[model samples]
Target: MTDLHFECTGARPEPFGASPTLLFGLRIEESDHQPVHAIALRCQIRIEPVRRQYEPEEVGMLGDLFGEPSRWSSTLKPMQFAHSSITVPGFTGTTDIDLPVPCTYDTEVASASYFRALSRGEIPLLFLFSGTVFTGRNGFRAEPIPWHKESSYLMPVDVWQQMIEEYFPNSGWLRLRKDCLESLRRYRSQRALSSWEQVFQELLATAGAKGGD
Candidate 1:
């Protein structure tokens, strides 16, 4: 595994399924490296229906695209793990990278609800989009978690844009924030998102954690 930097503001630990073993799901990467490939981001939000508990997803994107989503079964459980591609232009291959997540604390209720459950040990966290598991080339193609969205598994551009602003917003942060924002803006509808640029600036001022650069 590549050595990654992560941090947790309001995170702890919990248990997984079946075996119900304790698992930790907090932002673990704190680095200044730019993601090599994809312009998109993904996060693994831990949820527990039993106690109505959940955990905040990590907030950032890692390296570039390599291949397609390869589905495989967990050696211990029926739960499926989807391993995506991995490819960075000159970076050989990153053995370690964290998933990208947004500051849900200041945004929608889904995020709030998840955080609330996190403190209760009702769920365990995972980095679904980190280079540790999934990957992409040029840009990562996101599949919507059926549990997160009903229509398309791909994260709608607006949500992705907000996430970008939250984690890596500086011009030096990534060479493609402008492109990502522009793409999301193209998909913005009257009811979707109206102000990504403004949101980016606002989140930078508010979600003051010093990682995911």
Candidate 2:
């Protein structure tokens, strides 16, 4: 059995991708001098919300996901961030690979909302690794990568924000029902509203007026 060590060095925003993505740097080092042919690795990344403190505003933003902060004991659980896989080419003692973690801006996704709730500080992350490892210099032998092999990294919040900004600058993402969007579009046409923002403002104004009445 080959015992490989896993280390999460850090992460940064990917320069170019079809969508928002983060490139995590991982180092795989072998204890013995035995050469590693290749590694077919699958990584499951999770956000450890319970591992970090939340600000007042952040608490409010996360209320929809976790409910009241008082109930966080049961609510603040590890959320799935991304599931990614990569093939590490053959290497000797140590090898580094960039794990691409794609992201979405859809607020309906708890992961996206969880990320948006964070403004500053580091995000505690847990990376669970599993897969098959091929070893030997002359010939390759297959072995299962240890299931317990894992690593943790505190990723800076700015890295996420920067990636989002690159793809969704000065914008926020939301999902609306087809009928609801049609209704808003009809309202916009009727009132000659220029944008969806105007329609939302009008609705808020009307709701406030009714509340005061």
Candidate 3:
């Protein structure tokens, strides 16, 4: 059996990807210095929210997801970020690979909301690894990678911000129900609103007036 170790060296935004993507640099090593036929690797990435501190503004933004700060001890749990897989070609002793993690700007997602709330500092991440390892000295052999295999990484917040900015510059995404969308469209048409932003601005002004009264 090959004793394998995994490490996340760093991460960066994928410039040419069709969608928003993050490439994590992964390093894998074999203890016995044997020839590996290939590895079918599956990774589950999680965000450990409890591992980092939050700002006052961030807390306000996170209220919908985790509730109030007073109740955070129970609410602030690990959130699933992504599940990704890669097939590493045969290598001797050690090798490096990029794990492409597809990302979304949809703020309705818990992970995306949490990420957007952060102002600064690293996001604590836990990577759980599993899959099959094909290796042998003489011929092809297969072994199950242990379930206990895991790694931790502190991904810089700026990296995520940069990626989002590159794709959505000065904009954010929101998901609404079909009925609500149709209503907004009707409202916009009735008012002859040239853009969605204008429609939202008018609605907010109306809401503010109603609140004041």
Candidate 4:
């Protein structure tokens, strides 16, 4: 068995409230063991309040708008985990992890369209994966538990973009923005142009025939 180190970068933050957050980019390293397939390192979040009290106007407005379920306050809410995981293969060890959570406004919409309407940028949720060392057969295993801290605010996507640009200016951060747009465009194009599954099946058939030679 080969020893491999694994790291995950770009784990997004979960919405606790309007507080600023520090999102971490992961770096994993290991020796003497093969990396496990689909191992994820969960992130740790910590929140400290700068102000002591919630804004009266904000609270009032929430009560007026939500009618009763508005428990909006100054503290960050608990972090919510997504049903997703990161996959890696072969490993000696792994460390520092960041994984983005997919956003589906369906639940939010069903509960409160007002809350969903207030959304901007990407949602501040994270994907938590089981962290482990020891990949294939004949390898040693280390099971890791995920730890999460909650706050009372959501970090806007715009804030995250600005932070990225500031911290990693020379890293071609705009490329990531462009990539997100490009991916969305590609997905929309495929949906509009034809059946994606049919297209994929055709390509598979062509490849299989060629390989038969």
> Model 3, 1-213: lDDT tens per residue?
689999999999999889999999999999999999999999999999999988898899999899989999999989999999999999999899999999998988999988999999999999999999999989889999999999999999999999999888899878999999999999999999999999999999999999999
lDDT of each: 0.31, 0.91, 0.95, 0.42
TM-score for all models, in order of appearance? 0.23, 0.95, 0.97, 0.33
Q: Write the per-residue lDDT of candidate 2 for residues 1-213, one digit (tens) a residue.
A: 788999999999888899889999999998786898889999999999999988888898999899987899999889899999999998889998999998899988989989898989999999999999999767879999888999999999999999999888988867999998888888999999998888888999999999999
- Would you list the rank order by lDDT, best first? 3, 2, 4, 1
**Tens-place lDDT digits, model 1, residues 1-213:** 122333332321121222111122233331334343322233444322222222332111100110111311211111222222323132323323322232333322343332322232322222344433222345544332222211112122233333334443552222346888676556454336556665556557556655444
Off by over 4 Å in 4: 1-25, 29-76, 79-81, 91-100, 107-131, 135-139, 142-155, 159-213
As for TM-score, the candidate ahead, 1 or 4, is: 4
In model 2, which runs have C-alpha deviations exceeding 4 angstroms?
none
What is the Å distance of residue 98 in model 4 from its true position?
Answer: 7.2
Give me the overall lDDT of model 2: 0.91
lDDT of 3: 0.95
Distance (Å) between predicted and true CA of 65, model 4? 9.2
